[model samples]
Target chain A: LGLGLTASPLRAAGLEPNSFEDITSYNNYYEFGTGKDDPARYADQLTTDPWTIKIDGLVEKPGDYALSDLVPQMTIEERIYRFRCVEAWSMVVPWNGFELADLLELVGVKSGAKYVAFETVLRPEEMPGTRFPVLDWPYREGLRLDEARHPLTLLATGIYGKPMPNQNGAPIRLVVPWKYGFKYAKSISRITLTDQEPPTSWNMANAREYGFYSNVNPEVAHPRWSQATERRIGGGLFAKREPTLMFNGYDEVASLYQGMDLRKNF
Target chain B: MIDVVNRSVRAIPNWVLYVAGAVPVIWLYVLGFQNALGADPVDAIERNLGLWALWLLIAGLCITPLQRLTPLRLIKLRRPIGVVAFFYVLVHFLTWLVLDVQIPSQIVADIIKRPYVTVGMAALLLLLPLAVTSNNWSIRKMGARWRTVHKLVYPAVLLAGLHMVMQAKGFQLEPLVYLAAIAFLVAMRWMPLSSFRQAFVKR
Candidate 1:
């Protein structure tokens, strides 16, 4: 809670920042509920204090690291990022955190590690929605080692110059700006470095609809809806949908999947 | 008891049912304009209108069933309810066309490619004739044919129910409930328990 935060100059592709109201009110935190505003109403039950992240599997230094201990180890920087949801909605958010690479380095990734798997906190009592099988419990996500180590990958601890709201992944969350919003798992409690490609919750739930890579590709449309364009959050009902950019406007990330077919991977 | 209720229902003119049928759509529009329909207002409005259309269509289906089971003369309300449901379906289609799929080309492709959209459009198209011939004048002109033409509503309702079930994101209970309700209503029309009892008593 006492982590010092310094604002970074990293701006998100010239996109205007969404309002604080828009950021907090409209969310897809399934742990709290499926509805956009459900988290804001129900996430108060989640206990964020005295939290710990269990880093194990393919790590040289594997142990439970308390949040207080981890925050002090690295300088927290505010990075404004353009978050694109798989549902064709976009938001520019100011996130306060350090790089996932830094956190992985702190844990000391072992030589055999090929992927980094992330797991959200699974306290059914605190999270009322877990009782229903909206998704496989303890929502899981994974990144290829290179993607995890990339400079753009961040472990966001807060947003809008404030610690994250309970509904908005309070203690810690992954923010891979290049991938869809669901790829960035929220309320992350355990991160396991593994050799095999880990199973992501959405991908496991519906492989055709949600792919493992889940890169922001305008070409690959979800089975139910088109993803060629996205409506910017806070934009009124009549606002025209802006053309969606491949890799969410971070074209540099294309090198991450240079040879592989995105459509097949997707 | 039936006579008393029918007397009260008659006292209230048919115009009241028309206004009552319109209230939900008006409420949806107000919520949408006020930005009170949560984050995705377009989806909310579209879904609400479609659901209401399905509901009114179902309600129209129930008219004969209610008459069969009870002394209620809800036959006069059927045309008004069907007409209201047609308007709701019209608005639902418009919301999808104007809001969701702004590109005219894409809308055509969607109607052709997407099974749910095709089914929904078919349902709407099927209801058009019924709505047009709902007047007493057309009823007199068509006579025996009018009743046969209106039978299309059952298939339209079935397609509408299927459209809802297919459109849902996950295994939702709401769409399933709508389908079950329609199924029950249709089954009641075909095999009313009272009719079975009458047959048994006659034997």
Candidate 2:
């Protein structure tokens, strides 16, 4: 098990994982609250045990599967990815999980499925942010069928070899390194396969600011801020902002977006 | 009771306001030095300084309304408060320029291209002349014209509030509240004196 962990080919090269303090304390989980520190303060109220994920829509096996039963069947590995936010901040995280392709194969995707939609669990009793309509409640996200089936796509279950922190999406979460961090739905409750394009929370909130395909392209700027550079979190007080790269330095995903105009798709 | 409150307010030196105003910036610097500002100290420092400036500016604007409506008189210390607020605004601008966006070209582009940055820069420019001529000598030399020049603060405050509202990610309540408070204060100056007198007489 130790040998397999160190030899994982998915580890990002020439990057250091952010300190556990920074990773756990700083998050953008709006389900908890909008402030960076609100999640750390309020997320402990979440109940993750006995959690079950409802998988339905155009799948051969459609049922609520216990997290325990699903996790044991897959081979989990460390995937150090460069996590970038649409707000122009970046961090390196060591996430441990199996591929989404592996999970989809286990359930079997119908041939006609065109998109995969994800929904976050909304428990107003525990998540205080739900009282206000900061975002349309029960945040949702989706990806193209090809994007969801990409090998780099992940369903992260742990961080730094430890159980995921409640603030950082405790039981399970999605991680698409090539896209912005918001694309990674947290504390997911339901995942559905559909033929039509599905709506995402940020895109639904403001289509002009956020697009369905939120690929990290430095050439494409957000309507409010420039994406040319990103400030590295945990780089100390005087750290200079490094120039951002296309796909957040993941050139492997470029082929996936081969002929599409990223500016329009952004 | 009103007399005692007015006398107590008058007893406090103007220098005390200036000294107290310096404490927040000094404490923020100390926190930055100790690495206690969480993961992103630059952003935290920049936001805190800007908020302090806005709060002080709003407090300075409240003096006229307070005197008009109630017996509380903080008029004597308004100059010190305005000067201290300008100082915080200057530091906040410097933090953004020096620490957050270091590239000179990018800084110039941001001021030109970004609407929020453009409005913020306009507010800072408007405050420059007012801060430079805040002393008694300028007031005496210019006489009534000093009041005209000082009136620039109304537009400056409005622009600052707009800058705050525009920069937020979503529709946040804090920035909106600041803008609303500023709008109410600015409107108070335009209200007819008869209404205020009638309200005071009734009270």
- What does the lDDT read for residue B95 in candidate 1? 88
Q: Which ten residues in a row have the lowest lDDT in candidate 2 chain B?
A: B167-176
Clashing pairs in 1: none
Candidate 1 C-alpha lDDT tens digits along B1-203:
88887778777787898899888888988888888877678878887899889878998998887786566897877888899999999999998898777877778877887788999999999999999998999989999999999889888998999999887653455688899898887777568577755875688
The parts of candidate 1 lying over 4 Å away from their true place are A1-14, B1-5, B71-73, B195-203
Residues B14-125 of candidate 2: C-alpha lDDT, one tens digit per residue: 8898899899899998898788999888888998999989998999999988888777887987898899999999999999999898889889988988889899999999
Local distance difference test, candidate 1 = 0.86
Q: Would you list the C-alpha lDDT of every candidate in the order shown?
A: 0.86, 0.90
**Candidate 2 local lDDT, A99-122, one digit each (tens):** 999989999999999999999999
What DockQ does each listed candidate score? Answer: 0.35, 0.64
Tell me the TM-score of each prediction against the true structure.
0.89, 0.95
lDDT leader: 2
Candidate 2: which stretches are off by over 4 Å? A1-13, B193-203
